[model samples]
Target: MVEESAENVVPPTKGGGKKPKSAAAAAAEPVATSEAGNSPATESKVPPKKEKPPAVEAKPFTEFIQQDYLPALTQALADKGVSDLQLNLERAKIAIKGFETAPECSQVIGRWNGGNRQFNVYFFDDNIQGQRAISCVDLGHRASTLEAFVIDERKVTLDLLVAGVVLRLNSQKWLTRN
Candidate 1:
């Protein structure tokens, strides 16, 4: 009779139809002896840790427009050969004749070339994440107005806001020198 090795020995199954564990699987498994039989303890698996999202910059719209946007826009326009560009922040209604006199307007007007070239950005609300209407009169001619929303959804940072306005103006050739 041939001798059987301990590694090749198969554990008896209750139903007598279960497949025996292989040598590698039996060697890898932990041996536990209970009162009546051998049983493995339940595995406790720890879940993977989740990564956090980046923080957004929360700046007040009016403050950002006044303190950050205006200066950056001025420099950007000046760099684009707009030397006479003038920027004004006012609270009044949007009108050609009485916009400067209106008390409820939330707008910033940029005028260059002796008031002949002008564009006004009218804020619908105090939040940059909302809407803004831009009306431009290029060389005494009214161009089609467009609405702008928050360019970056993640944050309302100064650079993103300024870049949005500057890019819009640049794309429309609104601030280009003639």
Candidate 2:
């Protein structure tokens, strides 16, 4: 077998022979000589005044809410709630006939799998059906009791019954409060 030696290896060069100058260098160089029409420096000396574009008209809040926030909120509410109920995101209202007592409370189940958390909200007719299934792992750094409320269509109200913990969700990023 032939042995490899340092003398046979080619040494790296600072500049490869006869390589063309980079486009950046070409662009940076002067475009014209003294005899030409104008040099870049002279042309740029008295720069043309920039005219500002006309201001765009702002959309009304109601229009914006109807167009954007309403649809998303409506879908989220439907995904969370039970059947036979109508949810209006624009008005921030949920209409359900069976949720009158504690046992019939809406349940928002959440689970944490070390790296991430998954959660789902359900509307229940009875305590057994609506009871949230919270994992022990999720509650490790979280409060024993967790509370959340439906807010103005776009926002959700999440409150920890016990403080000093981190709560995370599959749909959202992890949240922490001291």
Report the number of the highest-lDDT candidate: 1
Per-model lDDT = 0.69, 0.35
- Model 1 spans > 4 angstroms off: 1-57, 96-105, 141-146, 149-154, 176-178
The local lDDT score (0 to 100) that residue 66 gets in candidate 2 is 41
Please give the lDDT score for candidate 2.
0.35
Q: Candidate 1: what lDDT?
A: 0.69
Q: Which stretches of candidate 2 lie over 4 Å from their true place?
A: 1-29, 32-59, 85-178
Query: Candidate 1, residues 1-178: lDDT per residue as tens digits?
Result: 9899996777787886787888788899978856645343422233456996643335466676777779988987787777998898887666654344644547888898898878787776766666666776777775455455454466466666666667667766765534
What is the TM-score (0 to 1) of candidate 2?
A: 0.21
Instruction: Give per-residue CA lDDT, model 2, range 68-137, as digits (tens).
Output: 4334433443454412323221221122333233343333333334423433343332221122222222
* lDDT value, residue 82 of candidate 2: 19
